[model samples]
Target chain A: MALKHSVSGFLADRYDMETATGFLRKQAGKRLPPHTSWLHVFGSLSLLLFISQTITGIMLLIYYRPTPDEAHKSIQYITAEVNYGWLYRQIHAWGATLMILAVVLHMTRTYFFGAYKKPRELTWVSGVLIFIVTITFGFTGYLLPWNQIAFWATTVGTESANKIPIIGEWLRYFIRGGDVVTGETLSRFFVVHVIILPWALTGLIAVHLFLMRATNLATLEPVGEEKPIEPKHGIPFFPVHVCKESIVAVLLLAVLVTLSVLAPWEIGEPADPLVTPEHIKPEWYFLPSYQLLKYFEGPYGAFFGIVACSVPFLLLFLWPFLDRGKHRHPKKRPIAVGIGLVGLIGALVLGYLGHVSETEQTFFGTRYHIDHYGVPHRVADKSRDEGE
Target chain B: MSNRFLGNTEMNEPTPQPTRRSFLDWVIGLFSAVTVGAMTIPALAYFWPAAKGGKGGDVEVKEAANLKPGESAIVQLQGKAAIVRRDASGLVAYSAVCTHLGCLVKWDGARKEFLCPCHAAVFDASGRVVSGPAPAPLPAYKVKEVSGKVFVSTT
Candidate 1:
């Protein structure tokens, strides 16, 4: 007790300990808006996933080699040789997928609630920016595995920039660090995924959180309307809201562990620039865009495809300004809700198409071959002849 | 003492003179700019991708007799992907890097075409774009057959 008092006294001499503790306690006691629901957990869940990713990513980095020559070999070593290295790798991989999912869900919730209105415009803008950065994090991180899919997907992903008219070629060269995806490309991506993107994301998340705190969570109140939160009437941030977040975090960890244990991520064949994989598909998140780009062919197709893909992102970023509606409820704003649904459905359909493209699959009784353009063509079933 | 530090006449006159604080500010500004430039210039240069290694020279693919007709071998020419194919006419070579994207095109000996797997872009035996999204044909390289050995020029 005497030692504790001395330590506290030493700290108190340099800092206002009482005031700091009081301030933290006040923040913890702050009340959330009355309308705050279970749906709001997604944002916190995304944060949880990001934290888990950072921890796992750091652990994986201990053995990961950025060079193409050793990248795949290092991953194999980590998975098979090192103890629990596979667990860290799997958690990081699953964490990325879950993080993207959580971010999308959070954005969807925010959109449906019409939370991007009036004073909360900046918050919405920052949130959208964060979402874009998060997607980019996924894109850059996908290539770190240095596998066949990583190589080809990055090839296709970077090559898509070649449609940007005059600067396209230079841009591709810049992105790849050369004429082709080589060791240099791997180095560049490793630095970006590990260093540049993390810093960028941290800054973006800080800004987002700051804006959200400043504006407070958007209630179901109409635009330009504010319902003052009362301490007794609303949910207390401490023990109540924090408890909910804690439960979600625990559940998220359980799911991540379950995924890591059930299906550990495989380190596929190392990247071969010379031998392109026959079926090179990007991660599921990029499927919608990948399928969409297939439709745009020829000289002008790439340019148009780029524009088509960019339109949605542009719209999403500028949504706060575009949506001049007074209503916060989905029922009140029919047009906005309809457009949102259409986009959601369209993305889902495109993703499904992408999943099935360049492959033969039997849906119901008919065997259909989905081509590069994601167009289904009925083909004669050959499975009966070679049936089990 | 103040009057002695600044000449008595100068102190009496209300002339605008550079203060020590302003002088220090200017020095700090210059140092800051120099410091930033010192850091930024190297960083900017770092992003400008490493230069391709080695001077352009003849890279030996294999023995001219080794590669039979309709056979192709992908080799590194001056640190870039290059393909050497033996045809009925003669030994021909082209940069294997696809014109559509940077994917290395596989030599389809049966079809006698260079096939890019990324976007299904096809190039004929002559490195001409036959179909698909490739805007240009694969660039040809000079193949020299000397002393029973085939060499692809990287210049």
Candidate 2:
């Protein structure tokens, strides 16, 4: 008892620990909506995946060489030689993909439940920014391995920035740090991936979480429905909500570990600027936008495709205002629900098309054939082999 | 007086002990704690830095004479497959990792080229992609022949 008293006294003297504990307890005691369930756990799961990615990424940075010549070689060393290095790298890689997936799930849940309306506009906007930051994280990290696919995909990915009207070329040069993808590009991506992205993402996520806690989670029931009267209707954030989130995080970790163990991440051949791969495709999450661009014809088409695809984010940002109804239920908002479904199906279909690339078409008297491997080869080119 | 402070007039009656609700909470709380601890430990260990060592030193593949003219032997070099071939020109060692995706490539004697089963990417005798999806030639390692013994260095 004396020792306990002394420890408490020390904490109080040094840090005024009682006040801090009271503040934390107040925050933790906040009551969540009674209707919260498994679906509500996705946002926390995304945060968990983000933390996992950051930890594993830091581990990889210990052995990862950022220069073009040594980047791929260093990855090989980490995967093949270092202790549990393969697991670390695989977790980081798969964590990125899973994080994006969880973000989508969370966003869809929010939108369908009309949680973005009123008092939560900033929260939704911040969530959209988080999504963009997450994808940008994926894009910048894709080039770090300095492998064939990483090089070519990054080249193509950044080239899209060139499709902008006036500042296009300048933006591309600024991103690449030169006219071409070189050592400069690798260093730039490494800095952005390791330093800039994590800091920005953490700031945005903090704001998002702050706004969420301040506003409180939306109930699953519509606004007109009666709020439960009993004290048990709502749950405290400390033990109840936190424990549920913990369960979800554990499940997510299990999936990630299985993926990391069963199919460890592999680094492709070292990047050779002189040789471009026959089939160059960006990571899976970028496929929808990639296919959307292919539908258009020329430089102008690329711009149009980009603008069209980006319209959804703009709409999503302004959704609270655009969807000016007080209803939180889906049935009451038929048009919004319809549009959301259409957008989801369109994205999935476009992603599929991008993956298969098995389209042969004659556009303006030119025969264009995209093989199954996403390799675009001209049918009229007699010099090329028939099989590819 | 105690009931007033407790915010429940029914507290004077009696608090339930070992109820089904409390038991379920304990079960779930224990399970969650165990599962989360299991996941977090490995994740934290992965973040802890270990000794950094190079895996690129020279490795003795096989006897020089075993890799005869027009014959190729797939040898493991630091956990990656490598092909040591003796052609009409000279002895050359190439990484047997397919340039397309890092799948281990196999030496097809009849075809006399390395074939990747993952994607049909073919590398010719000198590691150049003759046909298929491979983008670049297979990476070649420095080969040294000393007293009928062959060694390859990826460094």
Candidate 3:
């Protein structure tokens, strides 16, 4: 219990709950939707991923600079300055991918499980928005390092935007802030990555959670049951679920740290407008787009690519209405669930394709053996000729 | 003389013993106890995570002599920035930090200077702030040779 002294007399607050038999008391004690299974862990994992990024990001920010000229050098200093600076960057880098993955999977799970049914539609929609924002965050962060791969990848991004016919050119200008990927682009991306997207997502998440509390976390009873179906599958959200999430999150962090320790992230060659990158690819999260670029032809390819990318959001936005089925079981609603699986697999395959060097196109065409993609690629053995 | 000695001494002075009395005294005593507890708890709690040291840094690059002559090395021994330098003497080590605004400096040997096209801050071999409005000089770390190995500080 907490005690507070009032102006006129002593006022006390009680932490204990009385076992009242009233209707309001019953509502207060009513258990939430029975999502006790591991299937629900991904949302918590997404939250954990965000926490990881924020922590790693703050640490990296101590070393990272926003200036176009000094940004890369500051990164080198972090690697060479304080201990484990590279680890900070690597963890955040990998954590961003994992964060995107976790949130996407969480949304997919919600869709497959029919958790987006009436009254919980906003939770699912906001979640989809969160996914898009996470990817946007990744895209903006990718260029902050300003390496060759980052440069060309962003070039691919901006140019792809320029293919949208009329608004395409304007949108590219809006995003890049001028003619091409220049100092303005870096500054603009910095703002979007560090401030804009995060602020927007934070508000969305708050509203999403409020709606979640209002909807009571959607229990696992039969959809049409009115007389209060069995509540045996339910569990308290705190000590039970939250505890598991903490453990899983710590373990995941440990694994990521080990990977970072074994192999730190490497910034490739500097961005040179004159020199073409040996072979460039986006961060793992954008493999699908890279693959899309490969499949499509010139300007039309970009337009089709944009349309392909935008379709998922449209589907996600309408998922609630489309999935108006009465069943929440895996046995039911096969089509929606199938779409989710195909999308996940498609993303994975595209990511795999992006990592392969043989099929990639590069100007010099000699970096095939340099840094293999897929996993986080770091610096190579340049002790003999680095800076030479 | 006795008063001076008494003022300095602890054994001679008489002190009052505790007595249960006024409500005001009791209230004052309670508030003081609460205040102390509040101050101590938060202070200790704040230090706990810091003490555990979740904050990690980079490994320091070792030895100015590891690379023979003008040989450059790309180091990913920690995580983010790669330390690329052909520095044979501790005289210089360029931060792979991009000069455009300190991303991660990369060396352009054909160009013979550090280039950060993000805003195009370039630095010469001396690690001096060569071109581009790099507000500060490239940091030169103190490294010594020990058993033929280079170590960078990542604390």
Candidate 4:
């Protein structure tokens, strides 16, 4: 715990005070890489966003009731009575989206730079779990508002869960609290969103920091025999990097605050167990799954769902082993980078398809472009049939 | 500052480096266990507690004419459907049967309390706790008067 080094007494006697200060200063400078620039701000920005979520989440919990009978009412009270409560909710919602985006970008940067290699597989996979939890956080939190949209969206979730082979019924039964989205379901989701997920994320973050303390930051691998010059491109973690992180945090907070101010929050109709909502869509993240649900039928569709779910886990668990090639320069490992990019693009496309109305289902899935010349010749007929 | 340079350049220096280690790998390992834990904690808590009940409360019923003075009715609420009664002056509502171990509450015309002799969950005219462990008061119903007849709301 002492700040003093083990050999402090020996060094102090050997060198004059000024010379010793100079010697320590030289060593500290050598420890940092010169390329330590501002682009690294994203990670700090992410940390700051999460802190915002924690604060806003706690504040919202003070007013937002979790029971189905009262959840919607509590949200309304917060929006109308608690000054800035509306803003806080909006910030939490949209800030979550932004956090996911930031995380993805961070991961992409790491992947492209080959940050998931030896001694770093743990970090990469942890990041992947965080991604999964972040999305889950969005889903579980979505239904707490008790809006018609949230209610129906979660209905889709329950229905989807029911489609799973063995324990589907039990799973859906538990999630909806006795086969229906009632007060019990609302309370269950509240406990998950507020208490459970955050606790998990906090532990992951701690291990994430601990691991960083153990393994050196993965620098860009030497490009084509041009090895990274010594005294790599980084600064000491103390004043230089900490100062920058704090500034980045401030800027991120500024942006989030501005967005929260501009877009106030709102709650929809109080959930009535008797009324069935018209639109049944899950959270934005689940859009891909919801979209996939349309493409597969019976068992095959179920298998595809399983595959989609497993891919993230597979990549997270086996990434260190999968991309074990020595080349850390992204351009050199085009296959891995391309694979990651393709997966991302597919996810985005699927998410988009999930939101767009799917009137008709086909083996080819929803409508796709034949070079996308406005519309395909048979497309109008297909859509017409779907409408009918 | 811009995209001109690539790779892990410090956009914002996090802190002074005592050592040059990256924390990411540890985070990855931690994520797997934490994910499982996050899911399990809420789920275990769910099955532990019993399910909650609905709202709808109890009601009251008065007597037509007890032909006595200064006496009260012993009412029942939340047991064996719904029932009520009336003493000399005030109204009391209770189930004709008793709650404790399913005995019966005998209306004591002498003392004016619905006395469950089996468990002794004694109740006053209101069927409220005059004594003993009846987790709740007896289920009660309402009373109203017609043109010539006084009718009680049953069930």
The interface root-mean-square deviation of each model, in the order shown, is 2.1, 12.8, 15.5, 22.1
Alpha carbon lDDT at A315, candidate 2 = 86
Error of 1 at B125 (Å): 2.9
Write out fnat for all predictions, comma-separated. Answer: 0.46, 0.00, 0.00, 0.00
Off by over 4 Å in 4: A1-39, A222-233, A238-240, A358-388, B1-155
Decreasing DockQ order of the candidates = 1, 2, 4, 3
Tell me the spans in candidate 3 whose CA falls farther than 4 Å from its real position.
Answer: A1-35, A221-233, A357-388, B1-155
Q: What does candidate 3's lDDT look like per residue over A140-210, in tens digits?
A: 99998887778767876776676666787667667776545667788889888888887887887788777
Model 2 clash pairs? none
RMSD of 4: 20.0
lDDT of 4 by residue, A117-156 (tens): 8777888778788888888888888889888777756665
Residue A292, candidate 3: alpha-carbon lDDT: 49
Q: DockQ score for model 1, please?
A: 0.39
**Tens-digit lDDT track for model 2 on A220-262?**
5655463643457788887998999998888888999999999
Of the pair 1 and 4, which is ahead by lDDT? 1
Runs with alpha carbons beyond 4 Å of true place in candidate 2: A1-5, A220-230, A359-388, B1-155
Q: What is the C-alpha lDDT of each candidate?
A: 0.85, 0.79, 0.66, 0.64
Between candidates 1 and 3, the one scoring higher on DockQ is 1
Q: For candidate 4, give the docking quality class from DockQ.
A: incorrect
